[model samples]
Target: MHALVGDAVRKACSELFSVELAEGQLQLQKTRKEFEGDITVVVFPLTKLSKLSPEATGEALGKFLTEQVAHVSKFNVVKGFLNLSMSAEFWKGFFAAALKQDDFGFASPNSAPHVMVEYSSPNTNKPLHLGHLRNNFLGYSVSEILKAVGHRVTKVQIINDRGIHICKSMVAWKNYGNGETPESSGLKGDKLVGKYYVEFDKAHKAQMKALIKQGMTEEQAAQQTAIMQEAQEMLRLWEARDEATIELWTKMNGWVYDGFASTYKSMGVDFDKLYYESNTYINGKEEVEKGLAAGAFFQKEDGSIWIDLTDEGLDQKALLRKDGTAMYITQDIGTAILRFRDFPDLAYQIYTVGNEQEYHFKVLFMILKKLGFEKADQCYHLSYGMVELPEGKMKSREGTVVDADDLMEEMATVAQEVSAEQGKLEGLPEAERNQLFHIIGTAALKYFLLRVDPKKNMLFDPKESIDFNGNTGPSVQYTYVRTQAIQRRYAEAHPGFNPKEANSEGHTLSTAESEVVAKMYEWPAVLRMAATTYNPADIAHYSYDLAKLYNAFYQDHQIVKETDEQARNFRLALTYKTGVVIREAMRLLGISMPDRM
Candidate 1:
């Protein structure tokens, strides 16, 4: 309807005003609540072409649209704006067509070029945390949104499995673990590893305090700490493939990987492939040497390879260290090029890293472009802001970060509490009830993390997220369940009822029904915007608004109880379609909706 009205206004300009509508000249918006039309056309831009006052231009366009556009039933001019209301036939026709479309508001699968999304690139030193939660959810949701809009998406992550961070965990465990494995400790492997990482920090800090008291500077003390030296030596040993070091590294990394798989399952996110810095850094070294040979990078006297990008508004960045070792950026470069090589048809890749790495990616892309990668310009950095709890930002070294597993469990517990208070799951079996709680809890966590703009730092409140009255996940889930409940009641009342069999042409939609249809009508546009921006928050808010509109419509309208079969079936169709859209939109956010929640 928006497109139809915009075209009508353009035609009116060409025919009635003798002007071609150029790009961005035709402006259409939803009419304000007090207006008498479904869409409002801004008349100010058209006034220049019409050679008349805004009011006169609007009046002329309104009259012309009504006469020529079939869906433009009537129009009114208020001040300088033209408000056009669509015909009832137009609204009902779309509703009927939408009901028959199994892929309504979604593009055909794989209609777009292949794209890869890299997210949740966690270091093996620790378990996943609140920050990892946001990263994984955002990346997964963006991948899903792109898929919905016809993109062939590849989900991947480059695990920081080999680093000084992981070495710290290994060193602490070796020195102080007493051979305590995850099984012996009855803890998750990643959690057990994370404990040693924290232990390393504590021991290192205590050593720093003692050294500072012994007439040493803080920096000297930091480097001289025994635990820090142990981690550094462990890293060197692992690099040399020392048998004992390699054995411990493999065993500990195995534990962390097992723990990660479990957490990812509970969080409902998955990857199609995994990349490791241990392997990619080798590729990065080869690439850096090639860049140097091609004059894209230069080597310093100390044997470090660096890319000079001062002309590109970025300073020189090191690709290889003075000791000829790969830096963090080096592995990133390898990972990016490796993905393009792995997926030959990939149009580009999106890196879902935090906002702090904005400069890093800029330099990386610039270097790639300089290195003559044709698709370098097509790459994207989906940088998001840090997530903070009410208590504040998390720190992994201090072990104050909110563990992802513990937080997920807390959310489910909160869901159980909220459901018990409402008495919504009274009759369910224990297993089924538990499933509902998981669904509801996971939805709340994902929705709250995703509802805000991706670039904005957000503070999460667990209690607020579970509230059913506000713009929370539970509220949207409740509305979807309500739609299902309405259909169930209708099905029981009329055992053979089918919304498809009803003749909707005979039904006149009430104002409430019209509003619901209007909200649903915006789904396609909302979905397109989300795909373009790579933001799941767009889909998140759209689901909430659609759910809100449907709940409002259901409050005063009768479906199964209506005397008119045409009206009853029409309302039932509305109910059915609302549930479909809500379910689909939430699914893109990597959230599941329970039927009875």
Candidate 2:
């Protein structure tokens, strides 16, 4: 609806005023607090073209706009700015259309190319942490936004289920676990395995200290050699298909998978495919050999294979270690090859990783291009900055890392407490209360993480972020509930008045309600921008703005007690449509709306 008005204004300016406006020149921007209008237009850019004073230009343009733009019912000139007030009839049409459409703000069928998003690459040695939660939420929300914008989206996850760290866990388990299972330990697989990992680190450090006290050089002490030996023994057992060791590994990994599945379910994340390192690690070794044969890769005397990417502004990347085992980059290359073969027409491959690995992805993509993968240039590193606490960085070694499950439980507990304290759970059953906590908890976490730009490091201020008061998830959820409450009351009071009935009388535009409706109409543009930029935070910010506008409109305007029947019904219909749009927008950010605060 806003687009229609902008188009009409632009056409009038171009054809009637002899001014060639830019595509987005006549944007429906928000007015300042002291301003009388809801949407403001800056006519400063048109002053030169009009060859007149700024105020004169604004006045002339405003007059032309009101006369020519059918959707815009009124306009006011404020110095060099033009504020547009859209017609109520136009809003009624827009609201009715929005209500009739199943997909509120989705793009047309023929819009854009396919994009692949990869996220949540958790290591096998440990379960997910607070950092992984942010990555997962951003990736999932962006994928959903892209799909809504008519882009074919492939959501993928690469499991970092192999490495020395994984081997360390295996070593600890083999030597000290005594064939104990996760069921026997009564712990999640990742937690059970993570415990032994900490144990190994402690023992390994003690052994190193002992070796150093004996006056041996760090390398000569063979401290690392002992750890590697233990790891190698376990790897040998695993490769030989030792039934006892395999059984334990499989059981522990299964428990971890179960834990991860539950977390994903609560967080509302899903993937089209899951790529495992164990399956893809060997694929690139053959590709490396081919690259070596083609002279694209070089081998050292000790047999380590590498690609020199310095010519492409990247450091040399190790393709295979001297021991011929696949490294992290090796598996990623193989996965890319396999994915390309699986989906030949994939236009973009996005890797949602941390900013610390920026150099790694840069090198990885350069190597792929060097190896003659033409589509390698299309790969993108969606490097989100780290999530630090208010104090500083979260260091796992210092035990400051927040576990994903524990964080969710904490948020849920807080939600429950706030609900009870506010006495909002009066009529909600116990089961319903529990469900609301889950929804509110997930929303708080997701909204807190997604409200900031992905490229900048965000400080998770525990006290401020988890608060149910102003500018948080709970606030937005409360606004939604309040709107729903009003609608429910109105429906009960006027049993014969159907919300779905199309109004022939047309709406009468109020200054405040028009502003709210205009903001609501901009949802499609916001979704499109976020999708194109791969920034889910844009949607988060946009939803917050919409909720704020709705809250202001609800507080100052009486929707249920309007005197005019046509005006009352029209306003109720507007509120109903706004509620739907807001709910859909929140869902795209993986947020749930409660019917009551």
Candidate 3:
């Protein structure tokens, strides 16, 4: 519809003013609600070509559009805006075309550029928590959106495998566990590792407090703590590949991977490939050496390597420590280089990370460019704010973070309770009921996290997220179920009724039906905007708004018992397509809709 109207408007300019339509002149948007039109074209920019007032330019364009464009049935000039109402024939024609096709608003697979999205990059020392939930959902949804728009997207994550944090867990587990293992303790491996990480912090704090009481300064006590010293020594040993330390590191990291797989499975997110810091840092070290040799970086007297980025308005950043160990940024540099080398056709590499790391990514990209990687400018940081619970902030080192696995289960339990109270799953068997509960539960969880713009800090409330009456996943699911019910009744009553049989030409649509069709017409545009911006919140809102529109139309009109065949079939087709779009939109958000519920 936009293409047809856009071309006509341009043609009108060429014919009327004998001037080419400039790039920014023809701006079209959804007509404001108070206006009686489908779409509005801003005429203020066109006044330059028309040599008339804004209102006069709008009048001329609106007059040309109504006569020249078949879909533009009638139009009005509201000051500088030309509001055009599309004809019923055009909408009905669109409905017929839409009915004949599936995958209506999506582009063909791999038709666009190749891209890579990196997310959920957790360290080996701790289990994933609520913060990881937001990261995983955002990354996964963005990848899905890119795919929907025809981009070949590779989803990946880099595991923070070698670090002092991992050493802390190893030291604590070795000293506290007299050979106790995850199997022996019957705990998830990541949780067990996290428990030990907390233990290391506790013991380090206690030792520091004891030393401080003995007249040492705070900094002196921190460095003198016995457990801290052990962890530091263990980190050095791991870096040197000492057999005992390497064995412990590999075993514990393996445990964490197992635990992470289970959590990711429950969360419905996955990676195409996993990059390990242990491996990538080796590459990063080599790159740093090459950079130092090439004078892109400098080596300090202490043997630490650094990049001077003050000219770029950032301070000098350390690439490697004095001990010649790779810093966090060093590993990132290696990963970026490795990925482009691995996927040579890559158009972009997006890092889905927290807003707190915005400056870190800026430096990383600047450093990548300085290293002479031509594609370094294509790197993007999909920075997002934090997700907090109603209580307060959580601390992973203090053992106060909400575990992802436990939170997912709690959401499922909440779904089950809500379902039972509403009698939503009465006829289903136990197994089916359990599966439905999971779908509804995870839908609630993902929707709540995704519906907010990624740049905003959001408070997540499980109770609010599960409501079927609100602008939520389950509400959209319920609307989908209603669509299915209409089709089922039609199927049951007429035996082989095809709604498309009545897809022939009709009266210019009544006001109610046109409003619904107008919203549907906006789907492709919404998809394009969402894909370009890499935001799932746009799709989330589209689904909710679509569901609301369908519900409003359903309440105001009769579908199964309308005496008019054309109207009934039109309404049925409308309901059916609405369901299709609602399902697809929610699917991109990683939310599943059940047929019955």
Candidate 4:
């Protein structure tokens, strides 16, 4: 309906005023202050065609809009801007039509293109940290936004389950003397396994220091040559299916998977497909063989496999090690082949990974294109910058890594405390209060992680990130809850308040309410832009704007106290619609709004 009004306004401006209004030239913006009007249209772009000042151009456009646009009630030309007001009758009709539609705020039927988003590729050797949180947030939100805009989206995760890193954990677990298991230690699987990994580094360093004290060369004492030997031994044990080794590995990996599932559930991220490095590494070698046979790659002197990407302005990438084992790039290549074979018509394949691996994806795409996979050109690396703390980058070596599950738990505890302090848990049952805390906590984390542009590095200040006030997720959730509270109060006051019984008549528009209504009308535009740009931050920003406008309206106007019953009911209806939009918007951002928070 808003698009219809904008189109009509554009056509009327072009035909009646001889103003060459380009498509998308005229923007519908809310006035900077409440005193101005609802939807403002800047006519400065038409100054050249009208051969008049901007104020005069605005006056001319305002006249055309009022005279021709049926939905527009009136227009005021103010300082080079045309502030056009929608008739109350138009909003009533708009809401009526919207109520009839089953899928309001969803994209139209013409949007169809399959998008596959890959994220949360955590190594099995360690649990997810703060960085993985950002990756998952972006990936999950992007998928939801695309789905809201009528695109078929597939969320995927690639588990880096096999590598030298896994061997590090395995070596540590083997040499530590104690035959303890995660079940025996009663620690979360990822944390238990991570402890062993840290132990390995400590032991290796101690061994190197001892060797250095014995007057060995620096390189020799560093045990750099022995690192590969130890790694290979671990891999050999793993491949030979040593009973104790396989059992430990399987048990540890099982715990990590279980822990990850819980974390993903709390964060509202799920995968349609999961690719494991263990399953795909051999496949990568097979793909490399195929490429070599097809003249897409060449062999090194030492029996290693490599792909020359110099012609494409990229350095040559190694596909396989001299021992015929797959490397990191090799597994990715195999996965790409498998994915394309599964969904040949996939229009977009986005790898939501850290910015550190930007070059990896660049080379991967180029190699895929060179290997005759045309769909490689459509692949994108949504490279997001690192998430740093106030002090510096998070380093696991320094024991400064923020575990995903631990952070969530801490946030939930803080939310519970805040809820108690606000006396919001007065009559709620213990179970319900706990649930509310969880919801609020999850909302805080998801919103905080997603509010920033995905490509830019961001700080996750523990103190500031968890706050509910001031442009935070809790603020938006509180707005939603406040709207619900108003509806509840109104229902209690007028037990017979039936929406169908009240006619939206004599509902004169106040400046604040009009601004809210105008912003409300642009929900579709926000969704379209977010989906098309594949930027979830756009949705976050729009949701914040809507929340701010609605909160301002609530603060200034008394919906239930209005003398005109019809006006009160009409405002109630607008509040209801705003709640609906807020819920949908937050859902796309992978955040949930509590009914009462």
Best by lDDT: 1
> Model 2 lDDT vs. the true structure?
0.80
Residue pairs in collision within model 2: none
Q: Give the clashing residue pairs of candidate 3, or none.
A: none
Write down the worst ten-residue block by lDDT for model 2. Answer: 502-511
The sequence of per-residue lDDT tens digits that candidate 1 reaches over residues 1-597 is 777887787888899888899999888898998989899999988889999999999888888888888988988999988998998888888888888887899999999999999999999988998889999999999999999999999999999989799999999999899999989999999999999988988999999999999999999999999889989888888878899998999999999999999999999999999999999999888888899999999988988888888897778888998877778888988888888999899998999999989998889898889889888998999999998767677766545677899888888888998888878779889999988888888888899899999999998664454454679888899999999998899888678776766677788888889888888888999999999998899999999988888888888888779888788889988988899999999999999888896
RMSD of each: 1.5, 2.9, 2.0, 2.9
* Model 3 per-residue lDDT tens digits across residues 458-539: 8865445445468878788889999999899888988877765665355446677777888888899899999999899999
Question: What are the per-residue Cα lDDT tens digits for candidate 4 across 23-128?
Answer: 6577777656654555788777767767789888777777877787787778888778888777777766666666445467797553878879999989988888
RMSD after Cα superposition, model 2: 2.9
Whole-structure CA lDDT of model 3: 0.88
Candidate 4 Cα errors over 4 Å, as ranges: 1-56, 73-83, 99-102, 108-111, 214-228, 237-247, 463-465, 492-501, 561-563
Cα lDDT of candidate 1 equals 0.89
User: Residue 585 in candidate 1 has what lDDT?
Assistant: 95
Candidate 2 Cα misplacement greater than 4 A, ranges: 1-33, 37-41, 72-79, 108-112, 217-225, 236-248, 463-465, 493-497, 502-507, 561-563
lDDT of each: 0.89, 0.80, 0.88, 0.81
